[model samples]
Target: MEIEVRDLAGLGEWSAASALYRSVFGYVEPEFGVSPRLLAALHENSGSVIGAFDRGELVGFCYGFTAVEDGVIYHYSQAAAVAARAQGAGVGRRLKFAQAEAARRTGARTMRWTFDPYALRNAHFNFAVLGATAIRFLPDYYDDGSSDRVLVSWDLSGHVPAPSRSDEVVAPSDGRWSAPDPPDRVTLRAALIERFRAGGRLVEVTRRGEQAVYKFREADR
Candidate 1:
């Protein structure tokens, strides 16, 4: 499918972009949906909002803004959504690439975002395709009954790492990724948290059949 991506600038674009979020997220009502005014404010303030279209229909979008964390400025991507029918078609990847390019033009060097660690496909895309490193794992991040997340950071000027695997089991057969080892879940969580706090980075994620293997390396000095 031929997809067109460009900057989103007005209320008409926001209307479609908001609807795309509602559709992909399966929101039951408009009350909990993202509003066009909020998108407009983001567009006006940050100029990081972008959209993808298929024959004039908005099929996907990604937006972020520069934020200060630890006294450093970087792009924080808040959200990106693609229509269900158009998913797995590389639409999200294109949107992210566009977002990165926009960020670079504005003098930002890094982009931060979050994703569910249990989703292998997401893990593959973030680590393998986009070269993002999982720096922090937040438990109950969404409060959707143990739906935890991993905060990912992508360096705009870097390249994807070579493929590798970690001997440690990051996820079990049941797909409960947070519990790497049933007997020492608490210890594993603490270790991961401490590593990131010290600036560690997940260097590679290699899929082995039904399992996704993770490899972590020490923080770069």
Candidate 2:
């Protein structure tokens, strides 16, 4: 599979990217969907709207914008999605690296994003594959008490270090990537929140026997 990663421009491309985002995430609510107009505006600004193509067909896309926190400028990746057929083909990673390169060119040294804590696959990709570190855990990040997220920061300069020994661990039930049972999910969520509040930063996800364990280390003060 020959995947081409590049910047997306114009309404036609934006529209296609927008539709692909919605389709990949199975988003039906209008409020959850991104508009082509917004994409155009972001592209015009110092924001990144990157897409992965297979023979000119859009297969994956990611978008982010430059943001400042405490006077430190960084890129905040808003969302990224890959077509089901293109997943596991290295398309998502390509889109992210390309996005990081674009942000680096814009004078940003780091990129931040949020992901579901229960998605072990995503955790492995962010921490193990991309070498990102999770600094904060936001319970019900969307204010709906349902969308819990963990905020991660990736060094655009590729200077992230290997994870050290974990001070705490959150092991998934039955070795599953996600907790589908409501009670189990709630328990794991609480565990992660407690660990984060105790000043632990998630550094890696590793397998211990049959379980997938999320490893966290105390953040340097």
Candidate 3:
């Protein structure tokens, strides 16, 4: 498919972006859906909205707004979605790359977002492919009852060190499995959560058998 990805700069693209979001996330409730008006308002303010079109039909979109944490400004990617039929087609990655570039131009040094820590594919992509690191474990982070997530920060500043080696730090043992089925859902292991809260920074992840090993460094605090 000839995919064209560009800024969704006007209200004209909002409905299609919201429709794609609903289709991908399977949101049936109106309150849970993305509002074109809200999206348009975000673009009007200090935010961004990008859409991917396939033959003039919206296939995917990513949206986010500027945020400040610890006095550091960053872009908080609020939502990203691709139609079920268009997933695995490199659409999500492309959108993120574009987002990072756009964010840097706006003087942001990082982009923060969250995703299911139990989602192995997301882990691999966010950590291995995008070079982001998990900073916190947000249990029940949302109201929809599907809230378990790992808050991550992508280093748009391009100065963060490479992920430390897996063997350099203590690995959590709470949620180890004997190589379970691929792509199966699991919860955030309690031991890992403790490690994070105790000033640990996840620097590397490796898969052993059905077990996923995570490495962390003691926080400087």
Candidate 4:
């Protein structure tokens, strides 16, 4: 599928934007802050938003609003959603690059957002792909019970110029694994989701607690 990024306010774009988010996030009505009018407002002031389309079908989008947090003004490049079908083929990466350019033009130097730490894919994007290092990890930033959030910060000055080799850093390990800590009941095989920002492999112990799941990261072959 072909992917192109466009200004968020373009005709029929908001409908497509909402649909993309719905497909990607699968959240109920209570969770969202977007409406056609709110999206229009986002287009008028502060930072910008963009959508990825394939053959005239909206497949993905990245949006952010301006905010002052911790006494710092930032254009928080909050969230991006891609059609589930378009994942793995680099749609999300392109959407982010487009937003980065858009944010840069608006004089935004840094971007901040929140994401679930358990999503290995996001870990690859924020750290390995975007060259964004975490300033902190919040245990229950969302307080939703499931999927704890981590507050993320990105510097436009240090953006990655090319698609990241996220594959190389986080390779799946052997099957039926366990963390060294026994009482933890969190049986986890090692999956290298990323490496240290300073340069080393970052391995994650996938499942933590009783009722353990199957092998999370096993040998590819």
Q: What tens digits encode model 1's per-residue C-alpha lDDT throughout 1-221?
A: 78999999789999888888888899978686888888888787765889998888889998888887888778889899999878989999999999999888777889999987656667778888988888787887877665567898899988645544333445443353434555555555565566566666765656565455567876554
The candidate 4 region of ten consecutive residues with least summed lDDT is 211-220
Q: Deviation in angstroms for 18 in model 1?
A: 0.5
lDDT of the structure predicted as candidate 3: 0.77
Model 2 lDDT per residue over 88-132, tens place: 999988888998998898899999999987777888899989999
Error of 2 at 48 (Å): 0.4
* Model 3 per-residue lDDT tens digits across residues 31-127: 8898899888878777878888889888889999989977888999988998887889998898998888778877899999998765567777788
Best candidate, lDDT-wise?
Answer: 2
- Candidate 4, residues 1-221: lDDT per residue as tens digits? 87788887854788768766776778677556456566677888876678888888888888888878767677877678888788888988888777777777777777777765445556656666776544444555666654445555677887433433332222222223222243332222122122222232222323334222221222112
- TM-score, cand. 1: 0.84
Q: Model 3: number of clashes?
A: 1
Backbone clash pairs for candidate 2 read none
**Model 1: residues with Cα > 4 Å off, grouped in runs:** 29-31, 159-167, 174-199
Ordered by lDDT, highest first, the candidates read 2, 1, 3, 4
RMSD of 2: 1.8
Cα lDDT, model 2, residue 118: 77
- Estimate the TM-score for candidate 3: 0.85
Our tally of clashes for model 1 stands at: 0
True-structure RMSD for candidate 4: 8.6
**Which is the winner by lDDT between candidate 1 and candidate 4?**
1
- Give the distance in Å from residue 216's predicted Cα in candidate 1 to where it truly belongs: 0.6
